[model samples]
Target: MKFIAHINIMPKTELLDPQGKVVVKNLPNLGIQGVSDVRIGKHVTIALEAPSEQEAHDKVELACSKLLANVIMESYDFVIEAQ
Candidate 1:
């Protein structure tokens, strides 16, 4: 089976996000307001072949843990879909 994995990795809440803060502060000037608590993150798209949805999810999780995210300061989430 083929799967598409969408992964997002972000800094932990306790950590400061300078880029996100800057964007949030400037959004009102750009006529985009009322958007509070914006945090920046990384998105990754993965295409892979797996035996099952669970296998695909496990592969993505392993990838995130090994290379995609910094487990100490960042967290990751992913969605797996048939492709």
Candidate 2:
């Protein structure tokens, strides 16, 4: 079986996102208002072979923990689907 994973990596809430903050600070100049506490994140897609959805999930989690996301300051989530 093959699975496709959609992953999102984001800075932890307790951590400050400098890029997001920069965007928020410049929003007013673009006439955008009322949007606050913006946080920026990343999306990743991967396709791989697996025997089961649970197994695929576990693999993706390992990738996230070991390489994709920074466990100290970032968190991640993923969705696995058949392809």
Candidate 3:
């Protein structure tokens, strides 16, 4: 079976997002208002082969924990679908 995973990685809420802050600061300069804050994150998509949905889920989780996301600073979530 083939699976496609859509993953989102974001900085932990307790940490400051410098990129998001910069964007928020500049938004007002562009005449944009009413937005109090912003947070930047990463979206990743991967396609892989697995025998079962459970296997695909485990594989994606291992990938996220080992390489894709920084466990200390970033948190990640993923959804896997048949492809």
Candidate closest to the true structure, highest TM-score: 3
Task: Please name the candidate that would achieve the greatest lDDT relative to the true structure.
Answer: 3
Q: Each model's C-alpha lDDT?
A: 0.94, 0.95, 0.96
Query: Model 1, stretches more than 4 Å misplaced?
Result: none
By lDDT rank, best first, the candidates go: 3, 2, 1
Candidate 2, residue 71: how far the Cα is off, in Å: 1.1
Clash number for every model? 0, 0, 0
Candidate 2 clashes between residue pairs 3 or more apart in a chain or in different chains: none
Clashing pairs in 3: none
RMSD of 2: 0.8
**Model 3: residues >4 Å from true position, as ranges?**
none
- Which RMSD values do the candidates have, in order? 1.2, 0.8, 0.8
- Which of 1 and 3 is the better model by TM-score? 3
How would you encode candidate 3's per-residue C-alpha lDDT over 1-83 as one tens digit per residue?
A: 99999999999999999999999989989899988889999999999999999999999999999999998999999999998
> TM-scores for all candidates?
0.89, 0.94, 0.95
Displacement of residue 40 (Cα, Å) in model 3 is 0.7
TM-score: which is higher, 1 or 2? Answer: 2
* lDDT of candidate 2 over 1-51, digit per residue (tens): 999999999999999899999999999999999988799999999999998
